[model samples]
Target: MKTTTYNIDRINHLIQQYQLGKEEFLTLLSEGLKHPLTWEAVFKEEIQINHLKRIDKIFKKGLSYYLDPTAPVTSKESSIFFRKEKFGTNLNLASKKIVSQFEDLKISLSGLAKLSDINLERKLPVFHSHDNPVSVANTVRELLMPRFKKDPKKFLNALIDTFAEYNILVFEYVEHPSLKEKTNIDGFFLQPNVIVLRRNQDYFKREIFTLAHELGHYLLNQEEIESMDYDQMAFGKISKVEAWCNHFAFAFLAGNELLNLDKLPNLTARNDYNFNEIKTISDHTHLSFSAILTYLVKKDKVSGAIYAKMRRNQEEEIQNRKEEEKKKRELEKEMGKASTASLAKPIQSPLFVSTIQSAFFDGVINEFELCKTLNLKPNQLEKYLR
Candidate 1:
């Protein structure tokens, strides 16, 4: 076998980038390249070209990426705001890669917007730290058409579309194949105007809440990646900004009617609200059960102890449902009826899609460039174009 030499320092850097230990690196080399080499060669700072090729393949990076000493490092200038309780000081490599991908997508969308002559200077409503959360919510609500307030689905779609109109880019990040495990990042607001949402949440209501929360960050001009929970709002334990954002999202989604104490069921000593009442409110407002519970807690209708109990029950119910799903999938697999998991659907802003299509039609970008920008194959282009 003709073997070529590579820089040991670059090899070590690549291993670090992939978050691999020496043993794991050797295992990857043995498994991927089918060569079980000694640690002595690595200690001597020598690696075969074939091994380098295998390393490049495993990292999904080019050979030159490992070879070039001046290769640009991934930018970490942007600040990430995560919930300390969820992932304290343990930002995983997978999460960082996801953030990098988000930045790349934002750059592509911005370039396409500029090429299509779209107005990138559109103004978003501004809110100050001192502004009352309710007032800010009302201001945002006023910007939307009256129809959106009538339905939850319409409200969410309209909110996202409205943000896009104001030049705020919203993109959903689906976990990539390279990610070892899901990251706790529910959503993040990037500098200037970019919102990236993790598609791990099963409920659309949660996604809606995340969108609203990130929008609050945008309005306040604060950049943060966060895993927000309604429970964080209790006793003002969270930061002032996070608390404000939560309140803004709550008021925005729940609306002023929910704030009227007289409209809600009166909480008695026995806590006598029936399932019918819960269903009625849920149907009327289209809020999730968990969201309703949170609202009641926020409105002081429920005690913290009761709220915590309800939250626990809700989480248990969700876990049970997931277990049922897992069993069903297993049974399907055993019966040879299991379906292959579908490819991840990348969520793009409607405005971004339109701009890309416009650029393609106007000869500003070719088919290959269009497909690459959209993260689609040549054959998949028609599906998006149509």
Candidate 2:
């Protein structure tokens, strides 16, 4: 077998770029290559073609990249890892990897768009933390809001479609259930207009809220990688930019109904926390009950104790629902029915889809490149091509 010798300098540069420690990279290589190869054997010695191919798969850059001696070190300034000191939350390895994955996709999309002569520039006004969130939300709501739908999925899709019309790219990612390290982050907005969402299969409403929150960041022209927690809006100390985004998301989702929130009588022991009114608003707005309650808490209509108790109950209910769902899935599997969750694909932005299609049709990228860029298999390309 003709062995391939990977440039040690290129391998070292990629490891550093990914922030992978030497031992950690070696362990990954060991698992991926399926051989207990020592550091010296990989860097100082020639590796088999199969091993080199596995290394390329792990790095995700083409095999040619690792073979090139002249490949320059990737600039940290272009990466979120080095550019942002804070991301509104601590990013774990999975979170960082997910972000890096999308960042690379964004770069690919930009190049494709340029080649295809498709404009991906954001068509929205930028605002500041000092801007009035409610006013800003009202203005943006008019432009982005879709006809309300009670179903969370329909509403989310509609919002995403509206976003595409405005040239705001929304990409969703799904983590397989078997993955050991899962991302804790909900969503993030990248500058020059890209928003990435984590698919919340259990609670589509959370994904809806995440989309709105990331949109808030986009409008501010500020890049933020964040985990969306409504409780933080009520209790945790947050930056003004974060607060502005939260309020913006609320007002954007609630629309004219926000005016009525101020009018609702404050929650008290005698009022039963105005359950009926809150439920009605949640149904009409498609915002989660907890989200509405959190806003009420911010308005001082709901006491912290009341908010905490309600949140606890809601969480318990969600947990019970999850348990029920698990049993139901097990039952379905036993009965030989396909599980819908496993079949679900991450939502793709129409703008992104069109860009890739154009790139392929224009001879900018080949069929294999299209499938790779779209994360589809060759057989699955036909559905997307249409």
* Model 1 lDDT tens row, 1-386: 44554555666655654456788777766774445766775445455677677676555557776666564443344223221123312455456556656765666667776887876664866788799987888878777423545556555566667777777778886766575567766788776788888764456667777888888888898777667566765544677788788878777766755555336764454655444666666665546666677667766777777777767887898999989998998999999995786756756777677878888987889999889777888778888877
Question: CA lDDT of each candidate?
Answer: 0.68, 0.84
For all predicted structures, in order, the TM-scores are 0.76, 0.87
**Candidate 2's residue-wise lDDT over 238-293, tens digit each?**
99989988899989988878877779999987988898888888888877888898
Mark the regions of model 1 whose C-alpha exceeds 4 Å error after superposition.
Answer: 1-61, 68-90, 144-158, 176-179, 261-269, 273-279, 284-286, 334-344, 383-386
> Which residue ranges in model 2 land beyond 4 Å of their true spot?
1-4, 8-12, 19-64, 333-341, 375-386
Top TM-score model: 2
